[model samples]
Target: MKDAIFEVNNVSFSYEEANEKAMDQVSLSVPEGAFYAVLGQNGSGKSTLAKLLNGLYLPTSGQVLVCGMDTADEKNTWDIRQNAGMVFQNPDNQIVATIVEDDVAFGLENIGVAPTQMPGRIEQALLDVGMLEFRERAPHTLSGGQKQRIAIAGILAMEPRAIIFDEATAMLDPQGRKEVFAAVQKLNREKGITVLWITHFMEEAAQCQHVYIMEDGRIVMEGAPEEVFSLPEKMQALRLDAPAAARLAHRLREAGMPLKAGLLHMEETAKEVARACKLNSKA
Candidate 1:
């Protein structure tokens, strides 16, 4: 567990005046430099878990830690937030500056980054996300994908070791979604940043190193994409959809095509189907 950057222990949470627990005794560990995709239906504790990571919400009973900094501790709160930055659902809500570079540098400025060093950090952040071309452009003129990438640039400028994306692409179109996902993957691969992508998109989740399926505030299942999604019936029971390829494989199996499950990509599924047909013809 040396690589574990965040640890949650018997965490439970509920609104001060709410009737039911939003998150029940949920626990997990996130490793540094790993891309973890958290999926679930509504009220399944996905967002709540994201909040707990950065000390946005203290556990009602148990403990949550960011790089060993406890979320419930008042003094360590700043450390926790600094270690794990969060990107919320709405990109506009996270944007502050009219210009792209300024917005990206906003976090560094707030943390008292020396004015002399701001330029290099800002430039690097934008360039990393492929937004340097529009550094001087007004954010309002940019597309959703552009805006979201800019928002992420702001966080990256802070140089956090990890990030939690809570449905960050929920508001974007297909192209925008790809842009966001690509940026995230780039960060994980190029910069070695730990990424916790909380989303419902099976395709997006398929890109992760690991996937956790949650339901009714519990982690019903967790594993690699092929291990978890191979059981279509289990994923269906959790109210989670499989990736396009996995779904096609499921349909083919149902149709008596005799293809194997656990197909996370179209190429793999197609190859399996082709093999089945080839063998059938020989028989």
Candidate 2:
């Protein structure tokens, strides 16, 4: 029961009154307390899948289960929402209140957290995200990273079982992006929160426990990061980028060097290069 938090079984989706299905027979499962990254180009159904997990959109066919709660059933909708919360791409769009504390308190207020409990909940939420000092500050005054953290704090106040980041770093500068990603990773490591992160960034995708690649509204590949991203040519065919290490190794192999597949980081590639150089010297 604790191993799998989300189960999407052959799910398909079409926008309201639309002709084409946005998601076509897509399915995947996210394990509890795992960091999973979804990668694809624009309109690849990654965003649509994230929404289904959080109950923003119901599946047109098949099922999306969140901790045994079916999202398609209206009775389980509220409970499903409380269990899985979404943090979107734009920080500005997620800001509902002018002040940081109000933003964090918004979700709790909606669930009608008792008056006596609101203060403790809000404070703990901020503290968890390391934003307690900024609780009184205005939302607009914070950095992009800080704003996103507050948005997440709002959801954390609800004590969700998982968090979905839908291209949450797409709109920020490099520093801001790093801040947001770091904060999210910290929470997952310390709090054991399952994270379903959707992004096109290859570097970010490489950090996850597993990677799922979508194409034309379907999952084309799913595997551990090294296994999935190591194939540079295939990733390019899917209109996706490969991690730098994998790409570099691919090029080296193309130039007639003997190299293994799926070297994802610089350190790993460096070791390979040194090993090859020593072998050449011995030969």
Candidate 3:
């Protein structure tokens, strides 16, 4: 088994003056270079969990380890944040400079990277996110997707091994969401960077290697996308919908069709529907 990039053990967190825990006894592991998705609705502990993983918030109880370093230890704060970077919901909030390339260098500067070493890192990071052409452009003039890509490039320049995205696509349009997601996915696949993608979008989660569903600050479900989405009823009961294809596939199965469970994409669902119909016609 690959070494875990993140390990949460019996972790719990509660906001100050809040009546309930924000994260309750949650435990999970993210393997090195793996892509994991966390799905949850508003007020769920997903965002809080992201903060904890990045060492922004100490666990109210239990432990969170990043790259074998305990987050509770103040000494590991700097290295922890370096090893596990974060991209928040609003791209505007993350941008620190007027120029795109300067924004990319912000993290590198804080880490005390040498001036000479910075240009290469900045160029490569922008290239990786497909924003090299816009390196000299003003961030405020770019589209939402472009701005988000710049934010990702800034993190990439820091050379973090893992990234925690806290609903990073929530403020983006569909196109922007697609653009950001694709960039992050490419980094995971090609650069072997571990990702902790937190979002409420079922379609996005469907593409992840593993899915974790959070409700009321606790992990209500965790499995491969297919396994979890196959139970559309359970998902619906939680006031969440599975991906359209998964829901449709479940309905067909319930209606006496032998279509396979956990179909996610529309194309896959269409193919199965046709196959099932053909089988029925022969019968």
Q: Is candidate 1 or candidate 2 better by lDDT?
A: 2
TM-score of each: 0.95, 0.94, 0.98
lDDT for residue 119 in candidate 2, whole number 0-100: 90
The true-versus-predicted C-alpha distance at residue 149 of model 3, in Å, is 0.7
What residue runs in model 2 are displaced by over 4 Å at the alpha carbon? 256-260, 278-283
Q: Provide the clashing-pair count of each candidate structure.
A: 0, 0, 0
Write the residue-wise lDDT of candidate 1 on 51-91 in tens digits. 87888888888899889888888999877778899998899
Q: Using lDDT as the measure, which candidate wins?
A: 3
| Ranking according to lDDT, highest score first | 3, 2, 1
Compose the digit string of candidate 2's lDDT tens values, residues 3-36: 6889999999999987888899998999999999
Off by over 4 Å in 3: none
The reply for model 1, stretches above 4 Å from the true place, is 254-258
Candidate 3 colliding pairs: none
By TM-score, who's the top model here? Answer: 3
True-vs-predicted CA distance for residue 154, candidate 2, Å: 0.8
For model 1, the local distance difference test gives: 0.88
Clashes of 3: 0
